[model samples]
Target: MVLLFAALSATTQAQVTATIAQAGFGDLRPSDGFLVQHLQHGPVSIGELADKLGITAQGVSKTVIEMERKGYVTRTASSGDQRRRLVELTSRGWEAIYASRRARAEVNRQLRASLGPGAPAFLDQIHHLAEATGAVTLLTERRLRP
Candidate 1:
């Protein structure tokens, strides 16, 4: 019975994660939307983005290429290093960023409302997990949407 309950709990958690990822990310892949959100701050090198995202440069380049084709971002030569490519968000990209923020905010609001008095404790637990898992580093670099 205990093992069954544990399995059920894990399944429920996975479902919740998938639902949030689908609703919050919308049309773009989760990683792609995250990259767009990161670019909202300003331009960044592909290498820098890769490092921040904890992904490979080649992976970042592939996504950037797709985003570039979608007219969400532009790639230009870096001022200090012509060899480096800087990715900057376009107006469309900014729109995407805001849209993603709104979606995530709505989900978070609903989650908090459901948790009520437990929200703070729940968030604290999540923060601890993120830190223990090293996700805090990547999360801290991105702005938390209100």
Candidate 2:
């Protein structure tokens, strides 16, 4: 249970880590803007995005509206399903995501360098353990909630 809790904590912390790192946006904060960038993961409906992120459809819709207002994401009706709206990231949103990812990579490299050596082995071991029990797949969905 301790490991499970730790994993959950780490996941939640990571969700906000990039936002804090990319602070100083005008309208949308780093976290919300970051989500906007990810909005281009194909034509996803509210329920699909909510299911993947463990949020309610209403919450995802609210966020989508905010992203649209910020010009980060655009909403379009699905051709086959008029009732379903899809979210797509704008070019500006892609820029934010690319820049944020680059920044994160730089920070990660610096931290790894400070670790001195054998970090790859350590990371490999962690990945091995993570894969052993489908830990990465346990991304916490509403279906899995109590």
TM-score of each: 0.65, 0.67
Residues 13-91 of candidate 1 have per-residue lDDT tens digits of 4454456446443345555766776687789999998877778999899999998987889999988889999999988
Q: Largest lDDT belongs to which candidate?
A: 1
Off by over 4 Å in 2: 1-38, 138-146
Residue-pair clashes per prediction, in order, are 0, 0
Prediction 1 global C-alpha lDDT:
0.74
The ten-residue window of minimal lDDT in model 2 covers: 137-146
Give me candidate 1's TM-score against the actual structure: 0.65
Q: Please, what is the whole-model Cα lDDT of each candidate in the order they appear? A: 0.74, 0.66
Clashing pairs in 2: none
